[model samples]
Target: MREISLAEMPGLLGQEVGVSDWITVDQTMIDLFADATQDHQFIHVDPVRAAESPFGGTIAHGFLTLSLLSAMNFESIPKIREQTVGINYGFDRIRFVSPVRSGSRVRGRFTLADCRFRGAGMLMTTYDVAVEIENERKPALTASWITIVQFDPKDRPEGV
Candidate 1:
C-alpha cells in the first residue's frame, strides 16, 4: 500500500487515490462466495439456468463484489504513516450498477472523499469507490466507504 502521513491526507481530498490491479471473478470464485454466504440464487450459481435469464449467464453476487472492496482497498488505498491500526468503518452507501459476468475481470478506482480527526488520536476517512468491469461502459458497483485509523497518543501529531 502507498504510505502517506495523516497530515497529508486532507490535501488528497477530491483526488483519485489509486487504481487497483485487475482480478477475475471466475465461476469458481463466484461459487465459493455463494457457498460461504449460503446464497444459492440460480442467477449466481447456475450457468445453465442463468443463460435463459436476461443476464445470459451466471453473474457474481452483489455482496461478492462488495466484499472485494477490502482486497482492493488494501492494494490501492494509502496507509497512514503513524497509524497503529485501521479498521473498516462501514459504508455510507453502495449501489450495484451492473452485473459482473462469470470470468469477468474487475478493478477498483478510489478517490479520497473526506477526512477528519474523530477524537483522541483517531481519524475517520471516506472514499468514493468504483468497481469497474473490464471493457464495460458501466461500473459493477460504487460505494462511499469509510475507514477509521488509530494512532498511539505518542504517535499523533501535535494538536491532533
Candidate 2:
C-alpha cells in the first residue's frame, strides 16, 4: 500500500489501486453474514430451496459484499500521509451489479476518483471500488466511497 499525502493525491485522481486477492463466497460465509445481520431470508440460507429460486442457489446478500469493505481496506490497508485522522465519509453511488452466488470468488479493484479540499487541512477523496467476479465480465458490486482525512482533529470539516 502506497502512502500519499493529501496534497500529493491530486495527481492520482483516476489511478486504480491493486486488486485484492480473491475471496470465496461460500454457503458458510453467507450463512454467517445472515446470522450476524439477522437477515434470515430463505434465498440466502436454504440452499435446497434457493436452488429452486431464480438465483438458482443460495446467493450472498448485497450487504454482505458491502460488508467486505472493512476487510479489503484493512488488509494491506493504504495510509494517507500527513493526516491525523482518516474518517469514512460515506459512499455516493452504490450498485449491486451482479449476484455473488455461493462458492464464487470476488475481489475489489479500487480507483482513486476525485479529491477536494475541505475545512482547515482536511481533504476529501473518493474511491470507486469494483467488486469483480473471477473470470467474469460483469462486476459483482460497484460503489463510490468517500473519505475525509484531516491533519488535526481541529481541522475536521462540518457535516454536509
Which residue segments of model 2 deviate by more than 4 Å?
A: 153-160
Worst 10 residues of 2 by lDDT: 151-160
What's the distance in Å from true for residue 76, model 2?
Answer: 5.5
Per-residue C-alpha lDDT of model 2 across residues 1-160, encoded as one tens digit per residue: 6675554577777888556778999999999999999999999999999999999999999999988876776553367767787789899999999999999999988888888887677788888999998988999999999988778645343442
Tens digits of per-residue lDDT, candidate 1, 33-87, equal 9999999999999999999999999999999999998899889887788999889
By lDDT, the best candidate is 1
Clashes of each: 0, 0
Check candidate 2 and list the clashing pairs. Answer: none
How far residue 83's Cα lies from its native spot in candidate 2, in Å, is 2.9
lDDT, model 2: 0.82
lDDT of 2 at 101: 91
The CA lDDT of each predicted structure is 0.92, 0.82
